[model samples]
Target: MAIDILSHRDPKVATDILKIQQESYAVEAELINFSDIPPFRDSVQSIVENDETFIGYMIEEKIVGVLAYKEEQEEIDIYRMMVDPAYFRRGIGESLLKHLFATMPNKPVVVQTGKGNEPAVNLYLKYGFEPVDEVEVEPDVWIVMMKKAQ
Candidate 1:
């Protein structure tokens, strides 16, 4: 499996990305009003046209994962990231993270995850991301913010 990170907005890779989304976030994805669990969106033309802020991981020419971030003057704020379940536990997430650490300047990288999602929190911690704050989004849904830096 080859790893290729590309602009999150790449059009050629949307379909595969969409498939991964549909399979990964089914119900939780719908809570966000999404018909599917896309890291971003399939028709968000920006996913392919916007290059100022977005990144994705490709395998054998297909986009099996994605990482979207906003580059700020101080740190990179991650918007979303998801790996096709079939590709989980394979270090692809870590690779994308490593890529961010390698390319980000000097500010901490920020990310958010479902409050109860231990796996995500663990992944962040494994990469040195620590909890910074927590906020309630819905009456029952809380989000934990984590940050990491070089």
Candidate 2:
């Protein structure tokens, strides 16, 4: 897989990222028993306007995974990380994360994932992200916030 920076002005790239985001976040929603997760509510236009930088993982010229983040002061807040379910277990997510770490070696990274999404939470833990907090976004739906310091 190869990683490429995405252009927000490119409608096609934004559309592709939105598609991946919806597909991936749907699983998280189910795992956490919440259907109103932010990613599921995002539109292509909103994605284009987000101001976060997006990096896409391409396999055979097709985008199969994407990672989005924004740098704030000393921290990088990861807004989204998604891999096509078909591409799960293929290391695409890891590559995207490694790209982020390599590109911004000194910045602390922060992310939130559904507390019940073991795969995602485990992946973050494996990458050295320590669980720092949990927030209940809805009645019983909790998101686990994690961070990795530089």
Point to the candidate with the largest TM-score. 2
Per-model tally of clashing residue pairs: 3, 0
The worst-scoring run of ten residues by lDDT in candidate 2 lies at: 1-10
lDDT of 2 by residue, 1-150 (tens): 689898865888889988888889888888888888888778888887889999999988889999999999989999899999889999998999999999975988999999999999999999999999999888888899999988
Candidate 1 global CA lDDT score: 0.69
TM-score of each: 0.78, 0.96
Model 2, runs deviating above 4 Å: none
Q: Output the lDDT of residue 14, model 2.
A: 86
For candidate 1, report its TM-score: 0.78
The whole-model lDDT of each prediction reads 0.69, 0.90
